[model samples]
Target: MAGALLSTPNRVSLERLVQVAKERGYTAQGEMFSVADMAKLAQETLGCQAELLCGGLGGPNRDGVLQHLITGHPLLIPYDEDFNHEPCQKKGHKAHWAVSAGVLIGVQNVPSPGYIEDSELPGLFHPVPGAPHQPPSFPEESSPGAIFLLSKQGKSWHYQLWDYSQVRDSNLQLTDFSPARAADGRVYVVPAGGVKAGLCGQALLLSPQEGSHQLGLGHLPQLNPAH
Candidate 1:
């Protein structure tokens, strides 16, 4: 899904992607695909360069995610479903994947405390109702912002607007597994017994290979300087 969004005209089919993963031994019989496996598949199938970005102690930070999105590059973020702060019918240690498309900075007139409105994306953020509205804090030069996510549910894809702080906290609270760094400095999630894992906040930045198609930034919103 991510590869198809970032890649150009030459998009690989889902069946073909699975075939390639199996052929390259990226996945075994009846096993969940690891982050590294997905990255490798993106490279081979979509012709993208995947760079793993990790956060200290906490997984990926808001600034790091914003930086990557600012460059018009989509990111593959993995987080625990329970920590995502969204209403879920059934949830546990559900490790899920989401692709970030854009970001909106300096949200004005928050409807409620700790919540911001998402005019561009579907669904309004109203975590707290009737509470006094408080402005969201961001980096020194950045204003309050929200991230745009393209998430998959069953066979359909949905666009969501997630608060920056919520994203940061959820990522920090992710207790799914850990990614192991290879000798070449590449990180891969290899689930093994006795291996310390969990509380991993990481994201994979997908860059298009040379001569590949790129997503245009004209339609995406940018950070506007606060008045």
Candidate 2:
């Protein structure tokens, strides 16, 4: 319960999740939470939409810029499958706001580090052709190319998001539980059981800076005995 505990509800218009994030070092980007009640996310976190859960105030003006990023599914927003960036008004696409970002994968029920946005990074990785295994790394010196954070739904990224909003508010409840936090210290895994049931919680690896670690599936030793 010490790590990513359940988010407490804001029965009195006070989001304990937001408070905890701010105290720990993270800020929410959505309109629902204010700057005073925010953590790491200076603007909007990643500009990506979590499956059924939506983030960043969407409107005719907002979506017009980067509408393609809003794929309804959070993971799809990274979108390595569609490498051609012609830049158009796609239904799911949302404008990639120019802000330094980092990949933040949250394992549903394990201990891990907290995600903080930064200008540097592990580098931008886009899937490549002919070598789907070797992902292309785009250097982001001044700004992080992508902010890959993990979440279950509209309010599922931070542990507090669920404890405070979902379960507490009861506004958005996911019938499926998922996003299993892996033991590798990275790569949040939403096991089928988690998707069907619900996540226990996430672990918090203490770190001073953002983009501190990268996610690994932790099941490759068996898959690739060569190692």
Candidate 3:
């Protein structure tokens, strides 16, 4: 009943998800809810495409705030840590995500946080060769928000961060959950089962100051139970 009430036809709207994200302090954002190649593959292999939402989140302390929304998936946020003892001065890093054997790994793209545009990440990560793996100083200064990662695995989900040297574990219990108020005095909800979005799916960038890029829903033929 909780999931049913939260999702219509078993799907959550991107608009609703954005509303919740804004309440949590992430204002500038982007989403990748579907991919042309992935949709094609799903149609050819299973006759039904996978419908999910993935994207980026940028704001003050957005890196830490994003951890609350990550569950068994990945989100791209501005890399907020010092690299090998140097403080990053811009949005030059990204947190990439993938799941192997049910473990969600958030790979930190060091040296240079990747760029964020109207679409998804470039999908090509070239970390510095022989990058040093040293302890990152916590409570680092805030950087402009970047991207986010989301995914699903069987019945269980998780949101964990991993780099070449360490993995930081995090989780959000969103099932049958009630609305929660963040520091902004706004109440928001994380849908039951975490919104049925995907890690590497279709996405749009969210900017509190600008409009989003849109594709006619008519063109998205693979949207099952689309919102």
Winning model by lDDT? 1
**lDDT over C-alpha atoms for residue 142 of model 2:** 28
- Relative to the true structure, candidate 3 reaches a TM of 0.18
lDDT of 1 by residue, 60-170 (tens): 244555555655567776554543433132211444556666565554444345465567865455333334444344344333443434343222346666655555555
TM-score of each: 0.58, 0.17, 0.18
Q: What are the per-residue Cα lDDT tens digits for candidate 3 across 125-145?
A: 332223432322222323212
Q: lDDT at 217 for candidate 3?
A: 16
True-vs-predicted CA distance for residue 227, candidate 2, Å: 48
Backbone atom clashes (below 3 Å) for every candidate: 2, 39, 35
Q: Least accurate stretch of 10 residues (summed lDDT) in model 1?
A: 218-227
Please rank every candidate by TM-score, starting with the best: 1, 3, 2
lDDT of 3 at 7: 24
Winner of 2 and 3 under TM-score: 3
Q: Candidate 3 at residue 92, lDDT?
A: 18
For model 1 the TM-score comes to 0.58
